[model samples]
Target: MGKRSRWLLWMVVAVGVVGVVATGSNGGAGEGEGKGKVLEPVVTRIAFGSCANQSAPQPIWNAIIDFDPQVFIWLGDNVYGDTKRPFKLFGKERTFGPWKNAPRFIPSSPKELESRYLKAKSNPGYSRLRDTTQRSRWLLWMVVAVGVVGVVATGSNGGAGEGEGKGKVLEPVVTRIAFGSCANQSAPQPIWNAIIDFDPQVFIWLGDNVYGDTKRPFKLFGKERTFGPWKNAPRFIPSSPKELESRYLKAKSNPGYSRLRHTTQVIGTWDDHDYGLNDAGKEFGGKITNQKLLLDFLDEPQDSPRRKQEGVYTSYMFGPVGRQIKVILLDTRYHRDPLRSDGSVLGSSQWTWLEKELNGPKSAITIIGSSVQVISNLSATTRPLFSLESWGRFPKERNRLFKLIADTKREGVFFISGDVHFGEISRYDCATGYPLYDVTASGLTQAVEKAVPHVFSLIVRFVAWLTPTTMRVISKNCRFRSCTYGQPNFGAIEIDWSTAPVTLKLEVKDIVGYPVTGVKFSLVELQSRGSVPSVKAGEHRRHCSLEVNLRWMIKYRLAILFYCSVSALLLAMIGLAYAATLAFRLFLHKCKLD
Candidate 1:
């Protein structure tokens, strides 16, 4: 071969080698076929360490920050506060220069530990780590400062009301309690004025007290109704405590809420939106900082035990012994495991606390406040595609709660909940000892009907009707066929001690304090072994079953059958397409042979 031919052959060989190298670099073929392998710059990086001696050099912090971990877990002993120091046991006993006594290792006093923590916080290297991980970790100095404030407010004698009376109790014999949830701070909250007009002795906030975490404009049919290109885009994302604090301030500053706060004792627990994330659970990183912000909004004392605790669960007793009412507010956000895991809604600690509260001091009426519905499980009647936040999602936990109530035989027990964005009353009588009632009031300013277009009102009504529980239905005030009021509403409980048997009324009322739906019963009807007359009378007892109207199913049967027929038709078409492709390939092969 000539020189030019040899040169061309070498060039072709070089190009082939380059192609092979490119394929390997692009992960076309490699060890393990590169299926689950992660390349450089991994998406999520986590770093953790312990036993950081703040007094000594902290050069490792700079390198750790440089690594840019998405999460940095400080296991324990972030600072060496329990340090060793030389002690002179015999004070002023004329010890020799340095050979008299040896150094002793002693844990630091509270003040000294605090000073060491402050010193560690001021370290420049640690400050860089804090700046990088600001979204996840609460600042060490801020937590310490809050602790100091808590101690000062609580005092040595525990003057801040440590236990059951931690919440405000306005009445000696409480007869009226008003509660609601799901209020948007930016919207007009006239419902507060109505709640105050009812003259409720106590007011409870179930959750979603403010829309701190919402972004994106209200959309209808997946399109923004507002006139802007970025209307569908997220307007704001709350990543810091400041954002949540500002929203809380806006809600607290509402004139109506302020007046209600003064007129009645206000107490509350949080749901997902106010808890800093939608559908968030124990896994949310900023929960510690956000908890402080929530307590601040509630005007919790600087030294309240709630500040130091992991959750905000607490109980309050009002009135004298004969007419006493106990309100137990549960914190469902802080330690809640994820949905569908069947893990836990209330963590083990909260559950233990709940059992104690249930078995604690006797009261004529015991009201348990859960941020999510306890008795009404929408999953049973609503389509399986939809998932709502409720205790129903955790079946084991729900059963345990019921069994606890039965074992304790806590009489006059009923649940008040919010978060479903509608007003209704549910009752369960099977596992529970008595007719367990859950009065749910939601949408103080934000309602489901308002979120969608007016044209979709009928569809919303239909969906509500299809979802049937042991819902207590009164007159036509519950405009929905399923006895659910979707407009702005609140729940009210009234106890008439003047009656012979002491009548109790549970109501879901509108903005003007008009009863939308309610139930009237005697206090004796809530006993564990007592025979409830309402149940004997054959009231709605199927709690969370698939029972629905046969006529309604017949009306929609054609639509349901169409889905099945279309699925079969698609399968037939796919088979025909596969046969046609095979026949075409055979024809091509035969033509090539000819």
Candidate 2:
């Protein structure tokens, strides 16, 4: 090839380097793989999102259905946010939004909520989930039989581990869980089946699986754990589990839940519902107590990560180089300082720990989980109540986070978040720093108007404009930036880590598997800077090819002036060819005639 041709070919190869190619290990753990530490390099793809009110994940559920993922992380707000109820343990019930004003004279405490649980557990959805699995049916039958055999064997206490606050640690093999918000169960049912059928290594609960939030204002520890997670059994109160949360989870773990029980290892952290505090953090005085209560609900063996950290923060490792994904769940609310320059997203201890983690990174990919939007430039302020409750709220901390990732040179970092009642995908350029991509999933359900923050829609629009482009406002969808915890939705993050230059995709869908307007972009692992670079994106409308432009000419009139010269050379060559042909023909004429 000519020198010029070689250089042009090289340019094409160089351009191809920036675009990411997705390939990776078949995330499926080998059949009959023991439920121990998977020593084999794990090629894992995870789906994460949060803030789903238990109504029906409308328009958004489709995303979860189509994106059949391996691990689904529930960001938080799992149930319609039932606080003050017993750590609710019914099957599952859903509330469709347009947010309803909570009822007055709410169940006083766990005892009261237990009664409610009895009523709610009768829900069709709840019943199906509870009685779906054979093992679950057997357990239910056993619970009944054991109750009948009580006193003779073990006195009033009934059967073994009955109502005993001490939870049994069932080290999981593979668990299958259906992901859908509230009444929207069928929406992502296929995804759930895939999880079960495929039987991955783990499953996650992102949060907002139910919506039993108390309408009346609840003081810290206002309500208590209510009723048994199952049916009419001993209504005993152990520590932990907020009133409604207990009932809600019990309902979720129903026979329907059994299908998922022994399938895969499950781990999760809550964003809102389980705690009943929307967008709440440590700053909200109620958080510490809520955190403790949540710890109680998750009370597993001491070795369980949930019990160990018990904070809203945690991490998990998956796979080798084809991809190595490390997921870091942040409390955004727990240890965060104010948005001041000295503010902090990570508390002192967590910060140090996070720094240490970031300090050591050569992994193919990393993901950060925050229930609320982190990269979205918009805030939820239709009014102050719906005002910004995203990472943008704490600019100082947000910037610092960027600096940390960039300085640490961590690559393949993405944030999977939810809570705005809507869903979106965004890539942020830190003015000129590392690249951070944040994907928000708000599928599952919607909010009733005038939820919390009482953000006025008009005010919210103004706030969107005023909101600095950098302050959590990543897109033009005004609703996306705000903190409206009213609407419900399911969220998910899909990662392809089987090949070099890992690929991560963020998608949100309504309960029925429909459209969720969003964007997707990727980069080679080695080429990606932890943060979005400040380089301005080329904004030209008129299309122009570099080669075409380069070949056009150098100095202004040179092309026009040299045009004749070029034409002359071409003509001269043609003339020479004609003359030579004529001369040859003259010689050939004789031979031709012959």
Candidate 3:
């Protein structure tokens, strides 16, 4: 071959090696296994969402049903019963000087809230979703039972009988769980069909199960601002438990939701709205009564200890043996302290319970569900400008939780949260022994993207970009530059057991049940003794910065290498082309001289 041809061949080989290295480094675990290796099967699938308006057309259910998940979770805001309307004192409308009767908002009456829940329950699409899930569960149970009986009978005789051994049941071991929060009972919820399509076996409610608290703005006066001469002048006044109870009833009565209750295993905890107020905590007067109402909506057993508990925090274990999964649902609203107060979030009793849950029997995967963002500190990203409710509000408590996990040396633990009305995935590696991931799926219906006008989308995008959490995963699925998806979305967790190291696929899906952004990691990566360093609380910030930067580099290292290699190849080709052209010209000149 000509020297130029040989050079070209070498360049091609070099590029090929670079491409292989990049792909191999980022490829999923257990790739290129030897032939005939017995692979594990996917054992569980969980799905979740938040911020849905019950009264709205919930068309997303159809897409969810298509996913055919075995479990569904409600993160909260199952409905919007407590809402603001034009404020009136006695018989006259109140006016705030200059503003001229600027439609002050107040919480709806208990009776009114209940009626709204009832309306949400009546949504045909939601009802269909519930029915479909129930039927799927029934069929699954029957299949499992038959399969078990067949296997037992076949083995009873010691030796294979005539046709007994031939009886085979093709039951799948996969389990699917779905969850979401922040639904408005009065808004168009067109996402129910998509959720129903997923056919999840279990559903979890994270929080905002209902909008039971409405904002009560204060009026600006000559020297002081006030809540329009109201007796309490409160920013947000929670309705009595009676009103909350009514709303719960209305939500429970939702035909789609009701049907879902009968078929799929539904479980969840509460956030501020469903807890009877917005950003309320242990200070709320009616917390005791509201707690009961919330439990009743969940159909908690009359004799269960949860009913007698002060808070709704609870946990559950599913599957069996090595493939088991433990789900811990936290009540962030009931006993939470005011934001920035440095007080407790789970409270003393709940904290103790949590420790036990973490230290108890081991599960292949441990999922901790919170009603608010746990790992993402939005305040840190958007400090001074504004703050969002999150675990970061109580720095002490957040640290304590992180400490508990480290102390216990637990493995396979991650977090799922809601109430932010957007979907994103975050990972923190400083405090924990391994990279801790938090998948947040919010806005079942009430999404920030829809709430904002198209004209101001650019402004919102700019804000998102400016206020990115250190943990937010900047992936290709991001609709905005910030990697935050502000649309009707839900979270799905699929555990693939077939791989040597179990694979966990975490996703934040769109209105149509399509994944917009997600992350896939092997279960072994969540081991307590993984490569991540355990940083002391004092050294958190310094280490956090270094780790975050390192993580970014590690995550995109492949892309970086690929791009660099291509650029080099192009440069080399350009140089080679120039040299060949010069050499040809010299040859022609020499020939003319001869």
lDDT of each: 0.74, 0.46, 0.72
Distance from true location, Cα of 132 in model 3, Å: 3.3
> Would you give me the overall lDDT of model 3?
0.72
TM-score of each: 0.61, 0.47, 0.64
RMSD (CA, Å), candidate 1 to true, equals 30.6
RMSD in angstroms between candidate 2 and the native structure over all alpha carbons: 29.2
Misplaced by over 4 Å in model 2 are 1-203, 207-213, 217-245, 254-264, 283-289, 292-300, 305-310, 337-342, 380-385, 431-434, 446-488, 497-502, 523-526, 529-594
Best by lDDT: 1
Q: lDDT by residue for model 2 over 1-594, one digit each (tens)?
A: 112222322333332221112122225647543222212212245566665544443334334433433345667644343443323223242122344333322434676556554654454333333333333334333333332233123333335465442222111111121222231222223334333433334445555444434433323332432232333322222223355556555644543334444333454456655544444455555555565555444433444555555366777665433356666767665665544334666677777777888776566567777766666644322222234456766766777777787778776677777555555555565422445666566534443332346557555444333332322324343334442222344444455444354454444444333323344445463344434433224321111111112222321233344457789999999999999999999999989888
Candidate with maximal TM-score = 3
Q: For model 1, how does the per-residue alpha-carbon lDDT over 288-316 read when each residue is reduced to its tens digit?
A: 89888888887776777789989888888
Worst 10 residues of 2 by lDDT: 540-549
RMSD versus native structure for model 3: 26.8
Instruction: Choose 2 or 3, whichever is better by lDDT.
Output: 3
Order of models, best lDDT first: 1, 3, 2
